[model samples]
Structures are given as C-alpha cells and as structure tokens.
Target: MVASSSPANIDKSIPSNEYLLEMNIKKVKNILIANRDDRFESLKMIDDIQGLGIDLHFQHEIDQTLDMIYKECSQFYRYYGRDPHEAALCFRLLRQEGHSVQESFFGNILDKEGKFEDNLQNDVKGLVELYEASELGVEGEETLDSVRKFTFNRLIELCSGRESHQEREIMTSLMQPRHKTSRRLTSKRFITMIKIAGQEDEWLQSLLRVAEIDSIMLKSLIQEEMTRTFKWWTELGLEKELLKARNQPLKWYTWSMEILQDPTLSEQRLDLTKTISLIYVIDDIFDVYGELEELAIFTQVIERWDLERLEKLPRYMKVCFEALKMITTEISMKVCKSHGWDPTDSLRKSWASLFKAFLVEAKWFTSGYLPDTEEYMKNGVVSSGVHLVMLHVYFLLGKELTRDKVKLIESNPMLVYY
Candidate 1:
C-alpha cells in the first residue's frame, strides 16, 4: 500500500500488519526482559513505551513489570532514595498507579537548606522527569506545587539555546506536561522524533519497531470498534429523528477513545460512544428541533421513563426517547447479568438528571432568558452533561455502587469544570 502524504512515513517492516503486531509484542517483551533486573531502567523503559504510546498492546507485561518493581521497591529501597531521577520516576509511577508514595520521597535528595539541590538542576533528565512527574499533584500539595514551579522554570531556563536530545525532551516535557497531552498526539510526536534522531542502538531500533506496529494494530482495532457504533446508530434511526443534530459518529468515538483506549474497554467505549451520539441527537432536539411545549412533554416522559408516556411525546421525540430508553436498559441489563448487580434504577436516575438539565437549557434557549455568570455556571455544570456521562461510566466500570458516591456525583463537583 502507498503511504499518504502530509506527516506520513511508511513502515515496511514485518510485511503484514498481523506479523508486525506479533513481532512487536515479542520484541517489546525481549527489550524489557533484557533489562529486567535493573529496576530504574525497567521503569524508565516502561515509561518511555507508555509515553511513546504503545501501552495498550503491553498491558499484561506492563502490569507484571510494575508489580515486580513495586516489590523491588520494598527490597532495594536505597537506590531510589539515593538517586533523584529514579526517585522521581518511582514516586510518580507508583503514585499514578494509586500507590500512596508520599511527595516527601524527595527529602533524601533535598539539601539541608530544605530545597532541591541547585546542582540537581544541571541533571537534565532528572529535572525533566521531575517536571513531568510534578503534574500529578492533587490540591494542597504544597511541596509538589513548589517543585512544579521550580522544575518548570528551571527547564525553561535550561532550554535557552540548547539543542541536545535531552534538551528537546526537557522542552517537550515543559510544554505538553504528559498529563495534559493525549496519548495519540504524544505517540505521534515521539515516534517521529525517534525516527528523525537516527537511533543506532539495537534496543532503540526494537523499541521503534514495537511503537510502529502496536500503533497500527491499535488504529485498526479502534476503527473496527467504531464501525459497530456506526452500524448501531444507522439501525437505531437516530439520523431520521434528530435530523439537524450533529451526525459525527467518528468524532464521538475519537473523544471516547481519548479516555477509554484499552481494547478490553470495548464495551465501555461503545456504550459511552453510543451515549454521546444519543446526547448529540438529544441536544439538537432541545436546542433546534423541538418546540418549547413538545420539549417539556419529552423531558417529562424521560423523567417518568415510561414507555406509555413516550407515546404522548411528539412523533419526532418518540424515536429519540425510545432509543434512549433501549440503550439505557441494555447497559443496565448487561451490568445486572454480568456483575450480578441491578443498576437500572441508578442508570435511569442519571438519565433523568441529564434530561432535566437538557430541559433547563432548552427553556433558556427558547425563552431567551439569560442568567448571570454564577447562575449560568451552576446550570452549565449539569447541562454540560459530563456528570451524567461519568455517572453511567462509574456504573459501567463495575465498581461497587454506593449511595455516598452517587450523592457526590449528584453534587456535580469535578464535573463543574466542564
């Protein structure tokens, strides 16, 4: 096949996509196994593989590596405590994986003056790793907060007129800061950089091949998964119902893939993507298609969640409402059967909450009733629809459902930022 132009580089290794995937997986395993005993290097390789964004293909390997490293952390504790770079990588990776590695793990590297040593600033990799790691801090982490500021400014100063590979790495870390960067976007850039750098190391060549093949494998899988949604939407007759609604299934899939990229989360991705497509239709129903009176009836039918009541909805609203009901039930039943938990009530409630928010915005749109920023923001939290999305997702994740967590979701805390 011919490679397309525009940021295109043809990878002709392994002859077929299937062989590339097989060879890449085996190659990645060998690379890790070769450095298995070196905790810092193993973790660094894992980080680079993930940062370069072929992590999905290696979940089992990554998990085993991390688990081993976690055990090794307990056994060979001094290496991390003695080295700033290793300490940052370990602390960041462990904490990111939900281990409670304290922010104070840097204490061993700090001088008596209670500051990170000025000499450490000259250690480009350490400073860059520390800067990237600092992005994982929570609210009120004063030490990490200071470290973030320090490392960020230090890297900026360190980058002036510097053109080394580590310099480029530092600049990349400072600019994108990993947590804010998408895996796909980061992977593309990292892959391109790896290619351009003319890496001569056999290990790096293997890493590059793994990155390329795994990326192709995932792109194919993601495309295949998204095709199912396209078929479902077509058969569901949403396009006929919400005629002017944005009809971009691919866009919705891309957004969902951003968060749920694991191939195993195919169920969640489809469910969430389907929900997003429905919301796109519903949003248009509220914003453009439905009259105020019909919208009120439609919202009430959703609130009641009664099929008979859906009959009372305007004809345009009927298909949308039925589709919503069917998808919601399907999701709930899947949970009920597989997880042995009845989630229909919770799922229904979340839908009701989302529909109510839709109605609120619909009223505002029709009446031209403009609220002040505070009121707009308060309503926007729900109307933004992230909470409802997350509520359904929380259930989809199969976590033990609790009233307290449900109540917290209802409070619209993290979702307010949307």
Candidate 2:
C-alpha cells in the first residue's frame, strides 16, 4: 500500500560523498613528523591519532617517529617515567607501536612494598592510563594481573567524584581498551571526548581536524568497498546456487571489517569479505543441507584442490568449489605480484584443514555420536574455523613465517582456549 507523500516525507537525496572539505593527508603526516622530537608532545599526539581511529593511515610515520624516540631516550625509564600518567602512556604506546617494552617500567610509580602508590589515586589521568595499560597483559603476568584488579576498582570509585560524569571516556577504556574495541566506535567516541575536553596545542588541534576529516573519508571508502563487493557477489551468484543458505554479503563484509579494519586494506578487505561470503554458503551446506556422502566428497575435493575434482562435487557444491578456487587464485596472484610470495599452497592447506574439521562435525552430527567432554572440546576448537581464518589472512598479508612459527600457529594451545 502506497501512502500519500507528505511534507515530512519529502525527498532527501544522499550525496555520493559526505566530505565537503579538502582532505590533505600529506599535511597531517608532515605535522606529526615535525614534532617527533618532543617526547610528551609526540606521545600525546600518537594517543590522539590512535584514539581518533586514524592510526592506520599514519602507521609508518608513527612507527618511524617512535623508533627515533625509543632509541634516543629510552625515556620510558626516567623522570617522565616517574609520573604514572606519563609512564603508563609511554608503556602503552610503546608496546602498541611494536617496540619491546617491559612491564617493569611501572616500578617507578610503585612503592617499596611493590604496590601502586596510594597518592596515585588522586591523578585521574594516571589511574585511567594504568587501567588501560593493564588490560593488555598476557597470561601469567603477575604485576599486570594485580594492576588490572587494583585500577578497575579504583577507577570505578572515581565515577562518584565531582566532574567525573564527564569521564565517560575513562569508563569506556576501563571496560575495553582502545586496542581491543572496534575502530569505528572508538573513533567517534574519542573524537567526541577530545572535542568536549578541548586541546590547547595548535599542532594537536590541526591533527585532530585531520583525524576527523580522514575518518569521514575512510568511512566513505569502506562504503564504496562494500558496494564493489556486492557487485562481485552478484557476478558470483551464490544466491541462485545455494537456495537454502542465507545470502548475506553485507554481514560477511561487516565481520571482515571487525577482523581487519585498516582503510588501506580496502581491496584486500573486499577479497576477504567475498571469501567469507562463500565460506558462509559452504558452511551452511555442511551444517544443514549436505548429506554425509556429499559432505565426504566435498571435503575430499577440497583436499584434492584441483580443477578436475569439480566433477566429484554435487551440483550446488560445484559453484562453491569453483568460486573458492577462483578467489584463491585471484588472491594468490595479487599477493605474488605485490609481495613476491605464492599463497596458493598455504591457502589450499588451510581450506583442506577447514574442510576436515567441518567433516568431523558432519560425521558426528550424522552418526548421532555424543562424544565425551574432552573429545568434544578438542574437535570443537578446530571446527570453529578460527584457525583456518587466521592462517589464511596471515598468509595473505605476506608476512614471513618460519617453520617453527608455522607449527606454533597451526596448533597453538592458546587459540584453542582463546
């Protein structure tokens, strides 16, 4: 039923691009580079750059700048180190920049008894930084475990203090540190926080403007990438082939964004999203549609990993296999050209491993086998498709993988539980 158009329902056209201002990326890079010498200033700039969610664009610049600062001062261990706010900030940023940092730096703020000093509670910024820094701790790190527990309770108490209502940013950080949160949400949240609090430095103000403008453009770029992938999806025609499976290109793209959000990875993101979309169809077949015999053939086809094996797969699965093979080749060719490595072998291995895991579940489900807790848990981890996804992306990125590291990645104990 069509309703009569009213004034309130009047047409509003969406612009092709949201940005009206000139986006000078070079200018932002130059500004950050110009101040690489000032430790406090540079660290603050890095934090804002990250908080604003525009870090990916300036990563190389940030890395070089931090490298200079890291070697020049080891300032992570001195007078600035004595201040909890500065020390925590340095430690967090240093570790984030991929520089090796020791948690021992926190000793500067601790007392002879090895506790975060009582006086440190008065410093809101210090407590917030400590809380955030502590969140990055790995297992078995006693100091970080202790600090996380202490700062969490301490920061919760600060919410009652005057002007504390404005500390929503601190509250959010306590819940999930910047590194772990979605870039899209954190970018907007941090921009709001900084806008309200206001920075006094001219350079910071300029950089902040750049971050805002850049983030807007990046959003538009992602939108375009989504559109392009949708077009690719149409060409692939998964909806026609897999009538029972959910035809969800958009959702797959969103999931990929959560996995790898860098704007520069736009093309890579599209490829990955497309791969996941196909994975969704294939996964649904294994889960619900495919019979045991068909599932076995499909798993074997993946293991064989050849064009000739297409004849062995069932009708709908031929589409899935061909699509997977085509996409893998496309990704492989690009990676080879751009980074000089052949990802085909590794990708095939990952796909074969994933199919084996899927077949295990299919076998279990069909046989009505109720495995014991230990057996179920062991199979369930690999069956989760996480290892397959991680290994595929790792190979796609063209990072060097030593034999030992590859072994570690393939059967990492942490990933099973993680």
Candidate 3:
C-alpha cells in the first residue's frame, strides 16, 4: 500500500464526498506505512479523514475502519507477535473516532493474547504519553496510571513466561491506596447521579460496566494471589495468618464494617458489594453449595494436611481457607433464610454441588497434582464461589439473567484459575 500524500497535498475545494473517498484510501495506506514507526502521523491522517464529513455510514465505517486497522495491526502481531502499545493506540483511535466496534475488537485481542513484551515497555510508555496529551476527559489520572501499571506488569508476565509473580503484583496494585480510592470516588459519583435522576443514564451505565469489568479482573488477580500465597505457606512449612482478619469474629466483623464505612469504600459501594459478594459466593461453593463427595474430599484435604507442609498444591487447590469458610456460611445462610427455606434440607442442598466441587479441588491441591486443563476448567465452574455470588446478587438486584448469561460467565477462561 502506498503511503498517503503529506498534509500539504490535499485539494481543499473538492466536494465533500469525493474528498472523503480519496482521503479514506490515503489514510489507510498512510496508517499501514506508519505502522512500523511514527504513530502520530497515522493518527493525524485519520483525524483529517474524520474531519471530512465522510459518513462511511456509521456501522459500515466502524467495521471497515477496524478491518483495515487490524489488517495493518496484524502485520505487527505477525512480526513482533504482541505489541501492546500499537494495539492500545489502535483501540484509542477507534474510540476517539466514536467507533465502539474497534474498541471491543482490540479488547478481545488483548484479552486473548495477554500482554506485550517487557523490552517494548517504551512503546507502552509512549502510548500513555499520547493518551495523556489527548485529554479525553476520562476521570481519575491515578486510575489510568493503575491501569498502565497493570498493563506493564502483565507485559512482564508475558516476557518471563511464569505468571505467578506478576499476578501477585497485580493483586497488590489493585488493593493499592490510590486505585481503591479512585474506584470508590467514581462509584459514589455514579450512584448519586442515578439516584437523583431516578434512572440509569448512559454514562453512568457505562461507568458501572467498566467498574464491573475491573472488579472481575481484580477478583481474578486476588484468586491467583491466594493460590501463590498458599503455595508459599506449604513450601516453607509456615502457618501464617492468611486472611486479613484472623482470630476475633467480632473484630473481623468490625473491621469489615470499618472498611465499608470508609468514605472511599462507601463511594465504591457497588463494586465493594460485588467483591464481597463474590468472596462469599466462592466460600459457599466450597463449604455448602457443592455435592457430598466433593465436600468430603475438601474436608479430608484441609483436615488431614497442615497447609504449611505441602510442597505444591495443584493450581485449583489454592483458595484462601478462611475466606472460603467465612463467605460461604454468611451468604448461604442469608440466601436460604431470605428465600424462606427451612435452612436444614433446602438450604443445605442449595450449596451441595458447590461444596463437592471445592472438596475435589482441595484434594487436588493437597495431593500436589495438576489436572488436565479441561478438567480444571470443568471443576472451576462448580467451584467458583464468586460466580454463585454474582448470580445471587443478580437475583436480589432484580437484574435479568438468562441461560445465556450463565453460559457466558461459565465460559470465562479465568474460571479455570479456581
């Protein structure tokens, strides 16, 4: 593809349609050439085309533009195989031009491939600089910075090829003071806006969606950290206090209350609720939601072995024990009583399947045996306390959920992470 003529070569007086057609072709070509080096020039070309009043027809334009961009993007992936900077830029431009398709497209691409290499950190840094310069009016520079830090950390994971350490860093970062504060602020603003309007506004809905996605991601990271931490405990033969609140039940409850009462946490009530709900859901699955055989195995594992003595548990076996117990007992009791169940038979069976799955997972962990990926994934579906928690929340919140929704949640690959 031939690069477009420089900005100096455009004929200013042509009819808008013809000008747009010519500009489109030139822009595509220019972007392709500049794909290797010089992203700014390509962005400029796109901006010019956008200014031309070309209605490539909104949906058609979005589709064609993404196709062309990805075609060029594919070259970078084909050669270097994973340049997140280029990918991030590509998506940012698509969003700037009001093309949601490209944004979704790039998210899928990044989600599937993980992150770019560490040597290309400069590429990511440059992209951040460009994004800051653009001033898109997104809230919270610190939140964006957290995202950038996360992206870089993921890149490091990709480079090292062992994700445990990088995953730990991601968990720590998510719980960082600045990130949590920003999340709380954004959540409060959103809820307040909705309350005053008495309806869900588009912007608020979008913010909630973003928050949900972020929360889900953080939970996944936390799960990973739990696994790694468990491994460390087992390897070192150290009985460390794993849960944030350990001994005093009243103290734990008080601490939880304090966390909730904090202005930052209050602001992010929705997200915090979801996260806590997820923890409880996971706990219920392991303790009460699963089947008899599964529960038996889980009990056997936890009771038989000193967690600190095992060398390496299978990946699925690494859940936080206290978290599992606390969340399960709390949420299941609430859900059962609320639903008017007798709490013995009805409530007990409600969590039977989940418990069984957790037990199986614990057995695998204590045995230090890794199952096949497919088995791991299957077990994950049954074991995910968080998934059940979300389901309960959806039901309680009066949100619509179909079989399709359940499938989508089940299909998430991270479910395999236990």
- lDDT tens digits, residues 10-40, model 3? 8766545434434444444444344435444
Tens digits of per-residue lDDT, candidate 2, 1-418, equal 8977986765556322233223445666787888877777788888888887777778899898888777875755774666887878878888876787777777777789997788888787888888788877778878878888988888788787657555675677787787687767777777766776666856556666777767678777888988998899889887887788988888989988878877667777877787777667877989978889988888888888766666866788888888888999998898889777676777787778778878988898888988898887777676676666776677567677565666677556347566
Better of 1 and 3 by TM-score: 1
Which prediction has the highest TM-score against the true structure?
Answer: 2
Off by over 4 Å in 1: 1-20, 30-34, 71-78, 164-171, 195-200, 234-237, 240-244, 264-268, 287-294, 307-313, 333-342, 360-382, 394-418
Model 1 residue 302 distance off true place after TM-score fit, in angstroms: 1.2
| Count of backbone collisions within predicted model 2 | 0
Better of 1 and 2 by TM-score: 2
Q: After superposition, how far is residue 37 of candidate 3 from its true place, in Å?
A: 30
Give the local distance difference test score of model 1.
0.77
The order of the candidates by lDDT, greatest first, is: 1, 2, 3
How does model 3 score by TM-score?
0.31
